[model samples]
Target: MSLPPRAHQLHVLACHACGMVLEDALDSTGHGRCPRCTAVLHRRRPNSIARAWALLIAGLLFYIPANVLPVMFTSRLGSGSDNTILQGVIEFWHGGSYGVALVIFIASVVVPCSKFVILGLLLITVQRRSAWARRERARLYRLVELVGYWSMLDVLVVAIVAALVKFQSLSDIEPRSGILFFGMVVILTMLSAMQFDPRLIWDSEDT
Candidate 1:
């Protein structure tokens, strides 16, 4: 059977230098490069908008629990303690780790939520064919892409604490619901970043 029109068009734009056609580029690790110029020919991911929406929605759903539940449980000297993201931030602030706390709050909470909201707004604007500040919208999309990975900071912290604080009975750190939810939020945002297409913004400008 013949491929769809869009797929056929993508294939026609294959990089002559790399001999990579767009049809085979949708895999997670797959990329198409120009054989001659070594330039990227085309991104193979399909249904980028739909994938982004799915990820964004999932992230939004998980963000609630990531903030509400305890992210870490600390057991030291037979005394146990649990901290949510906000509680941890407050502790860090009061303990004079203000900078660290700020970084954690922004990366673990603010950035992800901001990306989701910004991307959703951009998508909605584009879908509505709103011609307002196309350039600005593109810039926002780039920002979202840049900040998407930082959401993993919380997960990294949890993993590191889990690894380093392995005192077994005397003192130990355990991952909590918030950590898992935070991880999901990060993954979902990353997926959203990957799925979003900046070209759509430009396409709106042309229309």
Candidate 2:
């Protein structure tokens, strides 16, 4: 008897949670619910394209305020000032903590914006059913997903800085509206990436 092909090429849906094959389940429910894990199974995620587009657009919109607004408020000896993400990075860079500044700039600004552009390109190419570099497109999806969570590094940095300064006698730090906006952007992008079905890249044979 011939063994089945690799698991991913099965052309069958499975329980995303419990690893249960769901091809048979489709005959029963329009969207089958896994008996083992209760996850809703689909040959393809329902409205995957639409949902990802919506989330991506929202993330893009939020990206504006995330950068423009101040992310932190700092007061030392009764003199206080607000710092946006770029401002903080510039200050850090000038203050000789270039490494931390670079990390913050990349994680906070570059990563988020690039994720938007990358997701946008993926969605468009998938919609057009463009067969260009199908394998590489799948790889791109993986790369974006891997880096998505790292954008939270900026938030972590802010929180740490705030905590450290909270107890200082003449200096204190508090997060600003921009940080909240940036967090929303990160979350929306993550959801967008999750909503995209990488399998779509492999659905068609490469030209």
Candidate 3:
């Protein structure tokens, strides 16, 4: 089957932000701005693949420390305890807070690992220019972006809990290094997703 012609083939560009179609002639300086929303337009994001890969790798490195080290330090009655991400989840589960445990497990462990795997898969497939599963790959990229937003839930939870525990006379909760690492993973993955251009999935087909 023949593919449809792209907008650039007709000397037009679509605004990524507002979806406005502008004539190629308007792009005098290599960069173009949409008249409606004035958002800058690019044929494709510059260095999208390379930037995404770099961020993904950095996030992966941080993921190790994020899970291994202590995320929260709790002190009560002259005794202190440190809890890693998994340890905290286990404690919540054993303490009968199943809902909270499930949320944290999904947000902290499952989400980050899934993002890494999916992003890595998309990156590899796109770089190889594989025409296989083009539609499904496109959907996977969108799904990555959607779930990236919730990846920071665990960090927020730690912060809120620490703040609430600050007022207790005999107990205190403070964030540890692991939470910082986890936060970096979340930010890096989110930026990696943003850097990716989903349009690339169809480039080979269009060619």
Q: Across residues 1-207, which tens digit of lDDT does each residue of candidate 1 receive?
A: 963454344545555346555454435435656656777656434576788888889989998998999999999999999989889889999999989999998997789879878989977886787888988888888888887898788888988998899898899999998889989988888888877877667654434
Pick by lDDT: 2 or 3, better one: 3
> Per-residue lDDT of 1-207 in model 2, one digit per residue for the tens?
974463345656677777787455475657668878887776677788999999999999999999899999999988899999999889989999999988888898888888998899999999988889987888889999988899998888889988888746588999999999999999999999999988787665533
Query: What overall lDDT, based on C-alpha atoms, would model 3 receive against the true structure?
Result: 0.89
> lDDT tens string, model 3, 116-199?
999999999999998999899999888888888797888898899898897465889999999999999999999999999888
- By lDDT, the candidates rank as 3, 2, 1
Provide the overall lDDT of each model, using Cα atoms, as 2-decimal numbers. 0.80, 0.86, 0.89
Ten-residue stretch with the least lDDT total in model 3:
25-34
lDDT of 1 at 138: 87
Clashing pairs in 3: none
Q: For model 1, what is the alpha-carbon lDDT of residue 85?
A: 88
TM-score, every prediction: 0.79, 0.89, 0.92
TM-score of 2: 0.89
lDDT of 2 at 109: 83
After superposition, the stretches of candidate 2 with alpha carbons farther than 4 Å from their true spots are 1-11, 25-28, 167-169
Off by over 4 Å in 1: 1-45
